[model samples]
Target: MEFSFSNSQKMIQKEVRRFAQEELAPQYSRWDREKQYPRELLRKMGSLGFIGTSVSQENGGLGESYITEGIICEEIARGDCSLPMATHVAGHLCAGLLEHGSQEVRDAFLAPLLAGEMIPAFCLTEPGSGTDAVAMQTSAEKKGAAYILNGEKSGITAIMDADVSLVFAKTDPAAGAKGVSCFVVPRNLPGVTMQGYEDLGCNAVVRGSLFLENVEIPASYLIGEEGTGFKMAMRGFDISRILLCLEAISPALVSLEETMAHVKKRVAFGRPLATFEGVSFPIVEHLSLLEAVRLLCYKALWLRDQGRSSSKEAGMVKWMAPRFATNAIRDCMLLHGHYGYTKEYPLEQRLRDVLAIEIADGTSQVSKLVVQREVMGREFLPYNYR
Candidate 1:
């Protein structure tokens, strides 16, 4: 199997890395401190065709491969973990919805989202529901040519600045997962309101609650066939989790590089800290894990590009990468001594950002269940036996 990136992919990596370093890295701290969304920078990225890497050219996107999308996410997170949220919203969430959405839905939303003129949010998790998405209380009642939606979606990322949202609500609650349907809801709709949260990290893309109080949207806003929202959302996560893994791990990789340089030059006692086994071994271990996880991420993406099922590999990395990266970043922070604990260094922030990934798309516990279900057959799932 080929292990290296193609020339074009390498170019994408170099360009994204340069852009992230020059544009995102400098302003990340300020944005995080102010809890601001970097809309203008995201527009810049869209202009450069970085925001919609997997979208087709006809849809105002770069039409690059999934591997290219992962590369962009990795480089963006390497510079500033919070910034890649824009890519996640634009590339994974919006693009995935557009793929399954009706022509009318795509016509109204896709272009502007690809252009970064509008930001999109995905609403699935609710106040009482997360891992068990089918338990959502949100309901969309059909009324002639429209649907009236009423419920609160909690812990929704990018909700604070989203111009539109892909919301899932139950149309037939008795049908369980099959009862759910997806809708493209505009932020300016009469009954739609939002409240931002004070999250621990990745503050640039604020998490928030979406309160849909009898929000009305035309029937044409529905995505795909009725009762397929759960499957569509899961498919979107299958694509997104891989990118999220990259987002979580890349920052730690950055921290490792920075720490490596510091330890090699900064002397402790009679020699540099790099000379010590305790200092050096952890770095080696983290580096190895990072490389392995990164490769798995690419493999999953490559499998997707080939139209193969990668849910198993995706689940593996989704659980492994974030947890490992969090530990790695924590290790790097401790190695930095007192400096790492302070806000002056990015290590502390990186740790916080990576920590969020552990719970973002899916928790490690849930991801392991997904991997188990895939490996050991669906009959072996806890819920199945229970």
Candidate 2:
């Protein structure tokens, strides 16, 4: 019931806020415009432990609380609003695989990833499969001491720049979800190829398709037990969705703050825009929604830290926050008039950046299905049979 951040958490928020404004805010627009990934800045963040907020200290990370990780994502998104936060979330997913990966896998991949010397991508979605992860077509056939991987992954974030990928493929195609397994595949492996996509937003992260043709990797690269990939991925999504919600909402909050200052000073029809109920009311409503969803995100993270199930809370925020953010930013842009629509201001970019989050972790409809299953019991699920 207590709702207050500890001194350490507050300190983390302040430090990250300061760093984000000073470093990321200045270059984000250019990066987005040029569709360039800020690898150098990411390395700096990794060196400072910002990239590994939720990772264990033993793995060369900060070993911070999940709430701290949420705060970090919020503050960073408040600045760049896209690529850095996406990359951070992707890194966290990779960290989860490392947690379950073998020591050799950790030493070979996790160490460099934590150090920011390398970037990793998470590949779960396929050309034919997204929400129905059990329907994935990617397969890895056991061959002696190795697995020959041959399949394609679509909508994989940061695939173009990633040195390693955490891939999910079927080891027993007929076993359905039980057939799936997770593997850490290096980009240098034979028959590994990638092609980038031109996205509507989040251009800097540059999502792409991954092609694995007769790719061979040692069986030791497999993470955890075979046939548990779907379960592990769902658990990771429970954590990532909360962080993704924070990232989506923080930029809208920042835009609102900026608009508030402008509305108070900019005159319209012989009065400041803030004096008009039309302008002020919508801003106030958005402010309230942002605050509410932000708290929901923190609550989810808190539950995670307490080792409690928060699937319902996570799904609620994941679906609601991004939709709220996109609408909120759009209103803020309109309030600014022509100035907001132009590239001269960051609001337009903010609009573009947040819109992508609606589809990133889970679609709004998919998240609602998650909440429905939790509340109405698994038997009531849409996919359940009579």
Candidate 3:
């Protein structure tokens, strides 16, 4: 049960931290205020091999481990949460495709994605389904040598700017989880439409809905075999939940450090705010929780790198990391009093950004259900329990 990073991993972490602090931190405030995504920065990330750290070197990637990917997400997120949205999770999606995609499919999508020439999105969540992905109504029916896809996917991150999407749709309505299949859907294909949407946070990145009405594509676009998309999608989430947890944790750490710095300088009643127990105690609690959540996230990533089944650990961290992070950031905001409510400082923005973790990847309640099922087995939730 080793918990520390290896020397190589430490080097990766240091490089990522330098990139984040030097390239991302300075412009984050301006970008957040303008709600702008730095595409050029993303290009730089790709050029530097940060975007495709997991894809094999044979496939034009750095062949970095999943733990390295987690480190990248954590460092980028620590400097600016939006960086992970623009480049981090997109990298994860590419890695998932590279892991499960066929040779032909890999030659087509993986190369471009690794080189940062194309952006990819994982389309699993729909209007009617989120945590329970089996409820996705998007249908992809086999039609001779092609598949006709029809349905709508909302709340998809980076869809608006992506060149292609790893779209998941039901192929066998009667098979439940086994009925799901993944397809590589190009945005420019016929009958494909998009509708943009807004979210309360991460405004720098684009969020939109994809509408596939009789969108036809060759059968070769299927990522894996039929009836295997559900498992593949779940695998992607297991990897991504760790990244999301890191993103959530980083912002809280940053806010905590910033608040601690501020309290040491800001005086109230002729003394620094840190002199008061009210301010310092919450800081202490936040620090303790942050350290604990950080360890959980690293452990999940390490287990993944070791090819271990991390469903239970991933589920537990998914619930704990974001919850702890948001609570800490919220408390930090309160410590700032009226200044936190204003947009002058980054506390309010950090609060808004970190709050989205509660819903992303998996909701709090849904994650609990995962933990429960792992501990109590499938019998805990009956087939008819809605």
Candidate 4:
């Protein structure tokens, strides 16, 4: 019913937009070119409490609503899309896991993570398994008061710089999905090793592989009970998928804005480029499409803020936002003519970064199946069985 942000939400939005544009936008491409992780800037964001919005105020977080979280994510992304990999959805997942962690775990890890003094990585996907997370080969064997973790987690964001990792491994392999347990494993453990990747976009994120060879940790490091990790991860995904969509939307909207300004001023054949229906209409269409999805993104966040299930809406926008945002950015690039293709402009990089959204969090195919299962009932799911 309410269509506008609250006074507090608006205040947060204004500040975030200013910080993002002033501090983040200038170096957006610099990090990409230098392949740097922007750790110092991340610390700055943390010092300003911009990194993780979900932590409780008592826990040194703002305890803001999911709607507020989306606002920050979208605005920060407007300035630089790649940084949210460390601050938004994935950051939330790390926070969510730590929220359920034991007090000692929270004291040692969560505090620094929220403060931006430390980087956190969520380890769920491995080189050999992702969608079928139950089939993961990572294992944690309990011995005495400790658990020895051994596995390789690939395609992880900020792995190279992460001070800690929420590692997923099967404590009881025979229990299938139920056997999986989450652990708060320090990335600097004796047995841990890492290698960075040469990714196509979001190069600043430094996505890489994590190899744990007999990594040992106290048994208290296990998050929740054994076999509950899968559900915890899935629950976090419901909101994270929505956040990822908003991240994609931010850059697309910014790209469109850049294109809009260029077309309005650039003249062709004695007429402004914006005067052409071909030029103006596509801009209008992209704006309209993105606005609709943007509203849906917030709606999903609102439902989450209400403590209601938003998986259906999350799945719907998860696929649509990235697919549409990428299209809009690509068109924006084309509309900019030769200038768009060059790295001098942000369009090409925006296009490349947005393209990664189509695959991150969840693939378009998997997202559709999530919606299918939700809307049509589990009985109709392709993998559903009585």
The residue ranges of model 2 lying beyond 4 angstroms of the native Cα positions read none
Which order, best to worst by lDDT? 4, 1, 2, 3
lDDT of each: 0.89, 0.88, 0.83, 0.89
lDDT of 3 by residue, 1-386 (tens): 66677899899889989988898888888887676878788878888788868877876778888888888888888778866865766788655765677788888888777667778877888999887889989999999999999999988887778789888899999888999999999999998888777777788877889999999999999977999988877787787887888898898999999999989999999999999998999999989988987887788777888889778777888888888988898898888888887888777777778788778778887777777888999787645332
lDDT of 4 by residue, 1-386 (tens): 99999999999999999999999999999999998888888888888878678778876688989999999999999999988977874459998888888999989988888878888889999988887777899999999999999989988988888889999999988888889999998977899999999999998999899999999999999998989999899999999999999999999999999999999899999999999999999999999999999999999999988999999999999999999999999999999999889999988888888888888888988899899989889888776331
- In order, what is each prediction's RMSD in angstroms? 1.3, 1.3, 1.8, 1.2
User: What tens-digit string does per-residue lDDT give for candidate 2 at 142-208?
Assistant: 9999999999999988899989999999999898888999998999988999999988888888899
* Steric collisions counted per model: 0, 0, 0, 0
Runs of candidate 1 with Cα error greater than 4 angstroms are none
Q: Looking at candidate 3, what is the lDDT of residue 143?
A: 95
lDDT of 1 at 346: 92
Backbone clashes in model 4, listed as residue pairs: none
Candidate 3 residue spans exceeding 4 A from truth: 382-386
